[model samples]
Target chain A: MNKSIIELKDIKRNFKVGNEIVHALRGVSFTVREGEFVTIMGTSGSGKSTLLNILGCLDTPTSGEYLLDGVPVRAMGKNERARLRNHKIGFVFQSYNLLAKTTAVENVELPLMYNSRISASERKGRAVNALTAVGLGDRLMHKSNQMSGGQMQRVAIARALVNDPAVILADEATGNLDTRTSFEILVLFQKLHAEGRTIIFVTHNPEIAQYSSRNIVLRDGQIKEDKVNEHILSAAGALAALPVPAED
Target chain B: MNGTNLFKIALRALNNNKTRAFLTMLGIIIGVASVITMLAIGQGSKKSIQAQIAEMGSNMIMIHPGADMRGGVRQDPSAMQTLKLEDYYNIRDEGKYISAISPSVNSSGQLIYGSHNAPSTIYGVSQDYLTIRQLSVEDGDMFTDQDIQTSAKVCIVGKTVVDNLFPGGGDPVGKVIRFNSIPFRITGVLKSKGYNSMGMDQDDVILAPYTTIMKRILAITYLQGINCSAITEDMTDQAIEDITSILRRNHKLKEDADDDFTIRSQQELSSMMNSTTDLMTILLACIAGISLVVGGIGIMNIMYVSVTERTREIGLRMSVGARGIDILSQFLIEAILISVTGGVIGVILGVGASFAVKYIAHWPIFIQGWSVMLSFIVCTVTGIFFGWYPAKKAAALDPIEAIRYE
Candidate 1:
């Protein structure tokens, strides 16, 4: 009975590559309810990136009915889509795309900079809160280059959470991290999800599907399987079970 | 995004590349500095020239006899004695704008005081000649009307003449000096004027009564020339017209005939020098302006490189809810900040350079407020003009491709 935050119906996308129409997404359909942690899994050439882009409002499906937070998205213009994306979606990339040489608090403040209604002081307050929420309270003033990969990714997550978007859309968010750091980031995501935050994590790694409540597998531009996992693995439990490494 | 936030973002980006930003601003700095310094030099020279003309009596007018065409043979202006004492008297009596008037007749002679003799021109003039020529008697008194009435043998000696004829440095006043075998008592010593811009010695002269030069020396009935000063500098043209008409009537010239005497004023010479200096100023500014254009091109080039280098940053901002226009403004503001900062520094450096030139190089320099304002506005415009294309390119980028850019 939960309200659907994202609903895609028969979404199709085509690209013309040198006079050949290549189908990137063919008749894809899904609905993600509020507060539900969903994983979109696919191999290469399976249109998962295209689906993530459409869900993030970075791209529009060629023909589809897309309702994000009950607002139709496919009919919106480029700028309106941008505004919708700003207000309703937060993006976390695999590379931890924090602005270089910028402090964590400032990087977290980036999303709110686009919102004119927020004053500078309010933006700083929200950024500080978001960073604290991501367990980066002590590293608020640390620059991106001065932090490790896991710390930089946490800052990126802090940026994604600052705007209080309807859904946090992560694209292979922990792909570049080592096994231990990946579990640490996954644990943070699991914690955010437990706090009733809607998350749509897209990746090619099938092992990540066990951590989410629902899984949608894409194959050859179509959804091959959509199912629910009754037993969701806790990333925090997995991180604690790993052996402690020798001190460097 | 709001302007200030975008500005802060742009500022941070520039801070990341401080060395590159400073190097980029160097072109605009040199260009604006040269423009201000050049304009200062030009204005300074023009002012100095005008001041020198004012020192020579800004409103003084000279009436010289024009060359006469006699039976297909042209007579020299000095040989033509059309300007007479009658014209001088007429101008003094009828000219409403005339403040001072004198008749001039000169004879070159050797001035002897004891064993010292100096070759100098003895200018025969009335008492008013001192005011007309802006000359002052430093010691003793000027000749009175009695001296002119009696065709006085009294004279005034200048500093050069004093140094030559009275080498012993005693008072030249009341001392009799012989000119061309005629002994004349020196009534005063004129103040030293040193040399003029033309390298002419201004203090090497003797002043005697015009009547004496016409009767005793040249033995001529007609005067050589006349000098008149207008009541004010602005009344020079009117004074010249009045003198011309009076001289024409006195010489009995017809309405259609040209005047036998020629009139000239210091204002004419001043305007000529002013035009020359203005031309030089414009030429220097134009040359400096070319460098400004080059500086603008340099901005465009650096902005392009910055856009290319920060593709990932632009993509990240866009993903974080920044619109295309926000990205564009961020880059544009960065460019403007560089230029405006350089402009401020350029203005300070230019003013400093102008003073340095005035002190070190001994060249006159005047810093005009408008010139500083002009360079500032120009540098701002240069920022916008050169920053547009690259910012547009950055804004139009595809976020996906930009994020993936190597």
Candidate 2:
């Protein structure tokens, strides 16, 4: 994959907290090419969340040149930014953020409601395809409250993919799950990565970084490290090593 | 997002808290209901007064004997005996505008018919009194001109007198009912006239020839009052003017002196009643409007609460590519739906309540179609007006801050 889906240059963000200037991101810059599985690692107050917010188009950098698939994001108007978020970027939250009591297919169809070009039947069809792609074909009718945490996350993933966005951004996607369930979700990400999907993961867990193709570590509002993970952890291999579940 | 889909989502959100939604709508429902009911009551009374005026003969007039003032006190006109039988004759025969006339003499007495007895007032009038008073004989026939000339003992009994004299609902015509020990044959029975607004039973009287009543009952010579009717409702004032001029010429009263006779018309009573009822309707409608305002405030309060409760939902929708206008429209639609729904329900309830009052409570109720339509329009405006603040608040929220809100 030669094309870059996201590019940032000298992205600076500051805030005034009671006569104090807090620099959340001090001129950080990076580029993530298409089809890359990149993980951004940081501890608390490292400004990774702020950086993710800018990437998700939920916030704009105070002064920076940020581009998503060659479109200038910082200069976009509010409605334009919203349209970009709807069509290009997909988000997966640590809490899964799947609408409670909403069926998986319905949740997946949410993003399509904003896309007026899509017909109702086409929207439903695409939602089903997306859920099936996330290995949740049988759980299309299942609501978040009725599903296990892992299953709910999968439903959230289906929601993120339903619009066929250019890049999928996950923030602490496995932070709430146990070790076995984390690996199962990570393996699903690996499968998606192998299908030529661009994925950006943000987490504080160092162990999770080893599973991605590249890692970028942030320290004190600046990038401290950026390199490929030479010894990649195979999530499927890790999942296979765990003992089989006992029948209920 | 499309309006239909946005409203669908809004409807679903409201459905999530069914009890709250219903409670919120109660305010509007009550407001609309009170507005409709108050207007109906006002309209109903106005209509009833008009009906009474029509029943009293719209074109009719009354001439009362003017009272003789003793110092600052004016005595009853009936005791003055200024109106004479000749005035009634001249008005009936000479006046072009006058259609009918009857010299009236009133006497109250206890009537005895067989073993049954009733106390009723007697009115002495000629056959033309029926048309002048807008009364019709429902049984037998009216007394002839010979009855008045010969001072006949034939008389007509009104519905209440019939009910009292004949308990079994038999035809009272040709039956003898003695008034003050003077026996008279019932010549006819008048149709029922129901009761007046003053709680007076209008059909509680018996009618006889004025000459007979004056000689036998009251032992008087002069007529008490003269009942006259004009050719049409509009001509009543002219007929009264003609009678006054004719009476003044005959009585030979000086131009400076006050006349001894007074001419009255149903229009005077009608206008007075209409103005009184008009003031009452306005007063009642204003009071009812206060309830509608209270209902609107309830809507505003609930909408504010709803916006606060659904902060996270608003954030979610905003983040999902919903523009500020989209968020605004969603919340606006929610408010409009609640109010319009409430308005529709209130209309049904108000109409039902009015009907119930009319049928069960035996009260007059006139429901104006415009009032129902007005309530609908008012409620819609109320929803939009009250919902605007909360909807704007929701639309103006910071998506990130909202998402993080508990």
Give the winner by lDDT.
1
Looking at model 2, what is the TM-score of chain A? Answer: 0.97
In candidate 2, stretches whose alpha carbon ends up further than 4 angstroms from where it belongs are: B33-50, B66-75, B80-82, B93-99, B110-119, B162-172, B175-183, B214-222, B230-261, B271-291
**C-alpha lDDT values of all predictions:** 0.90, 0.87
Tens digit per residue, CA lDDT, model 2, B17-111: 68888998999999899889888988998999899888888888888888779798999887886777777777777888988888899898899
lDDT of 1 by residue, B93-127 (tens): 99989999999999998888788898999999998
lDDT of 2 by residue, A1-248 (tens): 47999999999999889999999999999999999999999999999998998988989999989999999999888889888888998888887776656788888888888777888899999999999998989888887689999998888788788888889999899988988999989999999999999999999999989899999999989999999888888999999999988889
Note the B-chain TM-score for every model. 0.95, 0.87
